[model samples]
Target: MKNVETNKKIIQKKQVKIYYLSPEYVYYPIYNNNPKFFVKSKSNVFKETLLFEDNNTKNYSNISGQVMGMKNISGKNYLVLKNDFHEKYSAPKSFRRKVNKLTKKEILDILNENDAASYSSDIKYFINNFESIDSLILNLLICEDSDKIYSEVFNKYNSDILEMFDAISQIFEISNPVIMLSDTDDKNIEFVTNLSGMYPDIRIVLSHDKYPASHPLLITRKLNLSNALVLSSMDLYYLYSIVKRNKKVSEKMILISGDALNSDFIVETKLNVLISDIISLCKIKLTEDDVLCKNSAIRAEVVSIDDTIDTTVDAIIIAKKGNNNPKECINCGLCNKNCPQKINPQMYKLNNLPFPGKCINCNMCSYVCPRMIRKDI
Candidate 1:
């Protein structure tokens, strides 16, 4: 126990690369041991940074902020917007007003009406595209009551995970797969394990951690994983499933959250819903005359929802100000001081440190900044 604690302290002292892995396969990998040191490869790292920066709209080499991923497929491209994924958006009033008893059809219709595609298509696509396989390993945080969504299939297979496995086994000749429970709560893990055990041959492993252990690919690689299917949260999966069901299911789940909006409510919305519609759902109280946001402050570009009206669109961000480029160092050494490991932040920016593979990407520097400067890590 002492040795374990000592090792943890040492590992925490430096930067680390954390990733999330999917458990849709039979065998997955785990690092032999926690990674100790990071190799900084500037050319490789910078190239990767540029690849993910959405587009070359901003010059990143000269900037100290982190790069973000933003790619729009709506025929028109825009700058990457920094919005909260976990943060909720406002529920549509009509949808909320009628929330007395939402049937599956009403829910699907509401999402369809708002132009936000449901998860129906994506799920069907997974079922269709992949060769009929007998095994399934879902990441727990991503699973919702799919039995509720796919009533017909759930009804046929009983939607009980074990039943689903049994049905799958009948369809494809393969061994039963194990479900990895990412939750540390002993109760949740045991519940899933018990439920899974109902199947003839199924195994379960419970995991306890806050962030995703690593990207699914890395985890599977470490575990020697070869074949599997992966899934995400309900909303995302819903969208994917809907897309699979119908190609026209192009609606998106626009998540708006953070200190900006005091409320967080996930809503299904259309791919082309106006900014005003989104704000209305978000329950933002800004009047037409009141400045909605600081155009230059947000990572996303600004656009008008209606040319004749003053209201912004669902995709617009109304902040209080713009971001200022860093010119002078505060000399407080906060960036270096707050680093999980004692890495020099100044050196990171100055090109003195060529490789940032060790950086844990905890956003400690961004969190402690006086300027609220955004880093898209």
Candidate 2:
């Protein structure tokens, strides 16, 4: 029995890849020579200390599996653990106290401190306006990369999504919390169903459609559901931190991806950190023609280096700017077909058709266009 327990500990302590990013520090696994070696941030930590004995032999099948936690202190990056080998690095006593003794006012104060007061107001508004809500839908779908980061963190922490739901329900005295998954893939559905099975009150709804299915407006329209308070997985995670962990919304998990990037990364960093700082840490070199877009590649708005990181900025895409030359549309109908909202791009462009407010701005119309016309024009 002792041997089995010891083996379990060994398996749990197995070294995994960790990528720590902060304004002052960055540590990401480099796979060319050795998968375990990580480039240090601005810290003076020795390279020898970052590598593990089994890193050479251990295959890093999934980089997300390796990320344990991310921390930032006094604008400086501290130690990055390759594995959660010890609980000494656990939550601080103050944090534990906050989690244990959470109140509505305390949670609200934390949200306000983190620039998330709008969320508190929204919850209050909902509670005040509605006597009973049909369901509280937690949207698990963001863009592909953002969804991956959300799932990984949720799984890594073994977080109970229902805990957030319970807290909200208790506060409002509302019942029926549902998780809405926009992906219909067998694997994704199975995973969501399994996680939701542990909570009897929580149910799963599979939308399983193309792009824009995750959009709140579209979800509500398609699901024929009303009086539903829709929340993103990130939002719920923040709620969990407030109610259960007594943690502030200090950092956010974001995906940095694009053709111009040396490599894609799922990074967590301090809130309101400068985009320039993150780019520097990622070692991304931007050319004159490179463009940076926040959130989804399809729907997100273009941002600049001057912008600071925010909760809504899920993914940062650094890609080469498209051709500036605009050509007349050929009326291929490709744009209309690809559009998840079924809006006629050619009509909107040529005929000056009234703008459809339903447009989710999923740049698919621009992507499918042969003439490279700007859809926003």
Candidate 3:
């Protein structure tokens, strides 16, 4: 390979890589009830079998396996099962629908019928509350540099994603529907640019590859919209899968990346896949010095490797132990300047003021910290 100078600002597009995990076991976390709901301690389960239903959310088994009763993982109870390596589904596959012609109520019906939509999801909240949206934006880059779940999905399904976006705009009667991609994503930019003539309602806007810009509050300011329904790429993908692909929701995307690992990549695996299974399938090792964090590296909850990927987790970061001791604040103004909500984090850091109500709880202050002083503000 010849040495070539490249621009540091622009991130060249890489081939879309997806790692699949053939799990020997799938752990279904129990939420509302005990695992011993049936008469037998062991039973066979098909794919998409109803595990349990609670709080208006139905849980399903992601694989066909032999149930082995309850197993506790990291203090949480999960109904474990041994996989038979057979992907037998309880229900037959659905036929694809002409989603573009669907009414708003019909679309909502589809979301409600499927397991992908939830009562507490951000997308569902916005959709149910709005009569009409001003700007419908899909946020592909959500402030995490190593989290490539969104962008990688976009890379693999750019054309279909654009079609779905257009259909959503038409169905919602949104006057302005935009998608925010990283400015350095030239491959996606060119791909969408060539197809821009087909979908006039869909506008592709490049977002800054910097912190705080992808925040909902700052995104509205950047797009100059009164009110917007901003969704993550995964959020829209769930809807897309329900409408465009007409497939029952089974697999979920997760990004496993950190300095402790050899490289960064995304994994497309079944829902509720165990973190330990992901690590083992990917051949990842956790040394004594390395720590595992859920969703974020510095400003996230520390998790054990046995944790299962529930609805809340999007990324698992395995980080090497470094100097995490908080240093004295040097009166730097980065926290104040980078705050998307305009509430000064410096006052709270110094114990001069309590945590303000206006704080959006973004990690901008810690992300911009030079001395790693403010890890959570």
Candidate 4:
């Protein structure tokens, strides 16, 4: 009778359910350690699982004072770093110095003194051939759904999209400013139309029929524009704050999503915060075998929870481990047919041709593969 009772307890433990939430889908329990069986469409559970209230306001640290110098490379100007910007500005003593003490000439001189090989082009461009930019391209397709997390964050921050457009125009002396959106779904297209209607001076272009349509090179090719500057929505927001409000790039907007999360929401936090810290704040629980992916599942790399978050990270995804025991390739030729860049993935592996330099690493071939081979190999 004791053995029978022990068996019953073991069965109960095996049946324990684990719920996970993502921006677009949800899943429950672990069956054979596979997420395929549990995947389902997102539902009203998102409202209850919201980690942050709609009206909650967060104060972010500012670091515009550390704008060491600007480097113009290949028609784009990048903000050079100075004096451990992310760290020093996030520290307690950062507020003691109310204003940035460095002048434009002083910042340039510092850039010259550093004189690293990597800094050569930028320093030389800024010194010799500095010209006012002509155009700015605002990329709004970074989020999976523009109407969901991104628009919510934009409205919550009380940022005016038109105001941002004007600010960037004036700062860069840009005459042709364009807002590019990827037409992945009907809702995204509708949102882009409504936004474009509000701003007459800004041009809106929709990219269709590509996996990574929002990629900078792809956007430049699709739009047929040259010498144009590209900036993400987050980048424009920070730039507006910097030029108008004297703010800095101290805070970052992060999208927390994936099947392993209990709830998925967008959170604004200080730069350099540890990934573990953000997970704790959201009250996320992870099992020993579950995996955490930085950015998108298709393009980003898997990282440990202990890693420190970088400024460029836009998304954090938690997912079950992928199936390593893939079946043999059936050679249905679907990988070649569906490849957006038209590279023969199968033939590339066989060394029938040189390396596919045009491959964008979008993972579409692997996604469409019947045998689950890694095309990126």
What TM-score fits each model? 0.39, 0.66, 0.86, 0.59
- Reference-based lDDT, residue 254, model 3: 78
Stretches of candidate 1 above 4 Å error? Answer: 1-137, 142-178, 184-191, 198-203, 212-214, 217-229, 234-256, 260-262, 286-347, 352-377
Q: What is candidate 4's CA lDDT for residue 218? A: 72
Evaluation by lDDT, superior candidate among 1 and 4: 4
Tens digits of lDDT, candidate 2, 1-377: 00011011101111222244334422322224333434333323321132322334221111111333335444432223332223121225345443324565665666544334333444444434546566677776533433545554555443455566656655555576767765544555676677665566777777654555667667777667787777766667666665554444546677777654545676776554567777877777788888887765555478877566655676787766767566887877777887777778778866666568977776677765667665766
Scored by lDDT, model 3 comes in at 0.69
Clashing pairs in 4: 64-248
Candidate 3: tens digits of C-alpha lDDT, residues 1-377? 01112112322234234555467777777766533354234788887677666555667676788888888766778778778878888767666566787888877777766654462267676557657567788777645534466677777766666767788888777889887877867777787788889987788898775655667777877889976888776676677777765555667777777654656657778767778878777777778877777776535567778778775677787766555666788876877887767778877876745567877776567655655655343
State in Å the error of residue 194, model 4. Answer: 6.3
lDDT ranking of the models: 3, 2, 4, 1
> Could you tally the backbone clashes for each prediction?
47, 1, 0, 1
Please give the lDDT score for candidate 2: 0.55
Give, for candidate 3, the lowest lDDT window spanning 10 residues.
1-10
**lDDT (10s digit) by residue, model 4, range 316-370:** 7666665644567688787787676778887874444544789887665665565
127: Cα error in model 1, Å: 9.8
Q: Of 3 and 4, which scores higher on lDDT?
A: 3
List pairs with backbone clashes in candidate 2. 26-41
Clashes of 3: 0
